[model samples]
Target chain A: MSSHPLDTALKLAPSASAAGHYTGQSSPAYWNMVGPFGGTTAATLLEAVLRHPDLLGEPLSLTVNYAGAVSAGEFEVQAQPVRTNRSTQHWVITQLQKDADGQPVVCTTATAVTAARRETWSVSDAPMPQVPPPEEVPRLDLARAVEWINRYEMRPVAGVIPQQWDGSGDSSLSQLWMRDQPPRPLDFCALAAMADIFFPRVWLRRATRVPAGTVSITTYFHVGLAELAATGPGYLLGQARAQEFRNGFFDQTAQLWNQAGQLLVSTHQVVYFKE
Target chain B: MSSHPLDTALKLAPSASAAGHYTGQSSPAYWNMVGPFGGTTAATLLEAVLRHPDLLGEPLSLTVNYAGAVSAGEFEVQAQPVRTNRSTQHWVITQLQKDADGQPVVCTTATAVTAARRETWSVSDAPMPQVPPPEEVPRLDLARAVEWINRYEMRPVAGVIPQQWDGSGDSSLSQLWMRDQPPRPLDFCALAAMADIFFPRVWLRRATRVPAGTVSITTYFHVGLAELAATGPGYLLGQARAQEFRNGFFDQTAQLWNQAGQLLVSTHQVVYFKE
Candidate 1:
């Protein structure tokens, strides 16, 4: 069996001297217009913490801050388990690369919480939006300009990407069914990346493709490891929309539901846009 | 005129020795059942960054992780500007206090982005929910068990706090009109605090007030400083609801709109709950 591109992209090696330091390289397969896809970077950061020796349990929440763009080369990640309680653990992570002058550059910063989940009274207030099954929807056949777009099989249901950039767009909402191209089993790391797979809301709301990138993203995992394992490699229903866009900034809120209509993760991101 | 209690609670004194370190004390006016209100803590952290000499612009987004419960006493906050771009600045902040053995303890970790906002193409997709105006609604008169409740006057319209703990709550949605008791002008700090001024959804969903508290919260400010100044001290509309509650955690998303029905901020949080 060959290693999946995602697995190869996320592979990390621990430093012998430092406890929390690990080194990894950016993959050309996940390259975006500017840098590696933000979702891939987010997944790599969470993977660093998930592989920590002192990890408590599954991830409950993860926040990734893209302080600066990552260069295509080797980078070091420091994932420190700052605090650990009986049932929960807190981690602080940083991705750093050396500049031309040999000074350390901060590419990203993140915080994650891991907890030992226990069964309790569970309820889902927001049910999955009614949409056609993935089998009925046709696969999206857009021109994959960015390399990262080829890694996912997307079936857009509503609010599809505007075909013409004529500045006549009205809605920012997008609902779709998506899964890994090679059908990898769902896990915390993959789920974190999938949470950010949607296009920028500004691009969807307006016909013009203004320059926009996410500044920060936060994802809350709604289920434990068992639920994710049960989900297998099935497609997830994703829906995202922007509430307001003003002053060169807008926020997008998104949700992912499993094939069984179980809410898996809900993520929010604020993007910086230029007029 | 004397200073408003909200301002008094957020007062910070910069340390002469450290560049980005400040000292502050918890205020009795905003005390919760366990510690000082989380909203006040968030506001204080943001205020520290806003007060920095090298501060660039207004806050665009903020994420605060409650690593541990804060005690009622003096705490030190370290707010560092880790990265600075042409129109945006990234900040990392931490709150610390001495433990029983006089060692520093981490209570909270946060990341914020401040941007020099410029005029841009904007839109409001999610309009304010239709409801009675603040003038027509009666002021809510619930018992003030927590001291923080007395600081804000809330007029709930729908999905108000449960009248009985019979687990009859079929909806976790809550809509209300709220303002500071002394009517402090709306600003980034006040708006950040107001974004979190909602009860835990678990308690609202079920009659039994099982122990619940916020673990992490991220707020995205959609408007600029000028709009907040224009809002003045008028009441703002707030709506919040739980998307799902499973295992030992649940996530809540909320929005705040001014009296003119302009969306100001949208916030999200994950809470830890006991069965």
Candidate 2:
């Protein structure tokens, strides 16, 4: 069933919203399959607008504009708040037909603004890479090139892996410890589902494959954090360089953290080189 | 103008039945800012039903999801047509605002589809790359930056180029052959106004100074040739590579052409990597 509803919305479920909101209380293994990315439908509509009970814990900063193509089957979601202020609370979501046409696709439209938590405030940090462990590294099938980031849960740190059976794929720009293996609670839509899992370091640094739509991307959020708690593991320190493809535009930049480093967010994009 | 009027109507201009459906009399700079992006508004109205006048020039494969922030002031654009097949034609666009109490707050919604363009097709002819001589280069000044992309009169077969320059840096890949230096016609909402001209190649490839919305951008618009008539000179090729940064998400790919090598449409985004 299209790869078993994406492996039941990517396994790892002890109780992370119990893998809910693929609609109909999840678990047919997430309706099993057809077309579900644009960051997994904006992280399943931010868990359907944070399971609104007037938006439970709040603290949202949702922004989705992945217009069209959800197609897997069984779809329906709704979140509405228009506007509210004590600090900030705005929401609007509507998906409706997983597509072929039940008709109703917006896919993503998020806005979360909340402020009022001061014991003192003012502390910016993230720069701590020195790793190892995750059951001693090893496990990255690479199939479907990790399907826009196999719905989270990655582990690799020991002598760094994925050298693809020893041919040594030349991988190093270290830092690993990611979460969502099943706990769920990390928000900002799991950093928009791990920013579409950095497309295999654009051909593992200098191997060259080139050609995939001008690749244009943008993510800018001044300072608004909170919603990351698979609890205990998550860190990704990496780097890459190629600053020029010329004339049609191709760009890059990256940084991510959380293993207890306390600086968890940074990204880059500009891919649109079509011929 | 702190920046709002529905963020300046996504860059204003609509009517004449939306500029007589994209094939004639266009340009107040494409009715004001459809290129050179930064707080502009309107056009999530699926470009008035995929350029309806019964669809023009035919060729479709689209993607646009810019979920929220969409604010500068005053907004309204709805656009519909979820299905229309016979080859194809799909549409959905929403950009709303009410917040202060009026209610609705959807701000940015997209979904576009339109087909029919027989070629039997295979792809790629490539060509176009021999820099120099757009009136002999040199004209990228902008009082320090921002002449609104020099009002569509671009000229870069590598002139006015500077990926890094203190004394004048050019770190690797740089291709510029721009158009409309008065010749007019930038076409297709001016390619989303140069899709965030990507911070001058992240400040001339780190010859130092980095700051542009941290990061998180995702864009994919495969193929849809033509519609770029800088009239005389036009070409923008700025490429970069700094292989993927884990967890937080980072990736790059860039390209945009017109000086006749052809390859007209391409764009991808996923940015917001705060460092």
Candidate 3:
């Protein structure tokens, strides 16, 4: 077994006869205050589709919904390709586990689209923000209250966690340089988890650490395997911000760029918050 | 039967026996060059859930994936609430239509979350762009080649459909004031359709009218039904821009605000483009 915590966390064993069903376990290495880190869960779902025998091409888009809280233990994941076109494929994935009554319950639901990409007219209209390189920026050592926070090394460029939770925060923008703590190779699964690496926008926007969790997150992958492989284990520049917060909910959008300035993934998430 | 095009397009009749199944027909009033307008299709799926007897609260987030080209004529939708909590519910929806072989095939898949929202600490960090009021801006008369273009009234504030196709355009930002024509009151369904009002960013960015369509879209509702109802039948300020375009796929983020500058809806979409 690989020693990487992420690898162990994402390990899945295929069902004996079922084509698309696999069982996996939650990793304590990536545990959050409530449950497993959502990023890791999202990555694990994508991992299932990537490992599926019927997968058509590289992943282009993924949307995952946290239907309910997942309990620690073994869980079953179903990644079935519902539609397969000449150049694209669509998949619906579900993560289910048993409840106290031993009845199977869904904890997460997701949809992903993979496509055989072709070279096209490409442009980077949203330029990488000019910022200090990761080497120059000092690494932020957040209080390791959450186990997941210790898995990634983050260099905060701005919008660090509020020192004074006095609700004086005026902006929700946060920019940071982040990568796996042990520096694993950059891949789809790693990128997916990294997309959700930033702290919840609500916490930063209000500077009030109220209860918050991601309800739904959608990520669009701009590059394919070749581009990602070329990136290796480099640090990714991540920037996130919230547009509006109202009625106990807010949405945040984020972008991740490689050190070479290639935009890798763009993600948007809606989060439930309690004031 | 309702005479309003939107109402007609969204009309659904419950299945005789199935709890979450409904049957509906496509309307020519909202037809595009290829198939029915995607936005209307998305709203129709949401409508099924809203009309479902087991529905819990107003919509908070919706993610729709266009799995295949939906054929015209009768289509069936299934909106199943997978999990319902005290304050939130998670739903999975699918749209299917009979293929040429008379076999039902999936065309679109969607997931939605509805919640009973409570008053909370709210703020609009992303302010609505200042622009001329709808009364001050003249309505744009698009060459109505596509039938759906005539369904709404649009006034371009910036980045109108490019006048030249010579690839001289530099940016992919579009700001406009738009609303349903014949003046219909704004609702979740109307807001859902309007979220996709902007032209694909590729056309405006490269000034090359390439074939493009949205593959997946996710919309987050920051306000509840009461806030939407208060807006009445007024023009919404809509602005959209693409952050990155690469390898035949690009993502765009948009925001819709009421006339009062209250952010009503925020949406993100990934589009497939051909060179």
Question: TM per model?
Answer: 0.99, 0.29, 0.99
DockQ of 1: 0.85
Please give, for residues B1-275, the per-residue lDDT of candidate 3 as tens digits. Answer: 44889999999999985998999998789898788899999999999999999999999999999998777799999999998988999999999999889998999999999999999889998899989899999888977469998999999999999887998989999999999987898999999999988899999999999999999999999888788888989889999999889988999999999999999999999999998
> What's model 2's interface RMSD, roughly to a tenth of an angstrom?
11.2
The per-prediction i-RMS, to one decimal, reads 0.8, 11.2, 0.7
Q: Return the lDDT, model 3, position B68.
A: 86
Distance (Å) between predicted and true CA of A73, model 3?
Answer: 0.9
Q: Write the per-residue lDDT of candidate 1 for residues B46-139, one digit (tens) a residue.
A: 9999999999989999999888888988999999998898888989899998899999998998999999999989899879999999999999
Question: How do the residues A1-275 of candidate 1 rate in per-residue lDDT, one tens digit apiece?
Answer: 89888898899999775888999998798898888999999999999998888889889999999988999999999999888888888888999999999998899999999999999999999899999999999998868479998999999999888899998888999999999888999988889999999999999899789899999999999998788999999999999999989979899999999989999999999998889
Q: What is the C-alpha RMSD of each candidate to the true structure, in Å?
A: 1.0, 21.9, 1.1
Encode model 3's per-residue lDDT on A21-135: one tens digit a residue: 9999998999998789999999999999999999898999999999887778899999999999988999999999999899999999999999999998899987889999999
lDDT of 2 by residue, A1-275 (tens): 23433334433222233222335323333221335545455555655655555653333234444334455445555555544444344554555554445545544343332222222212332345555545566644545542434545666542233444433333323345555544354555555555544443333333344443312223322233442544333543333222233333334444555555544444444333332
Candidate 2's C-alpha runs over 4 A off are A1-5, A8-73, A76-95, A98-176, A179-275, B1-198, B206-275
> How many Å off is the CA of A189 in candidate 3?
0.5
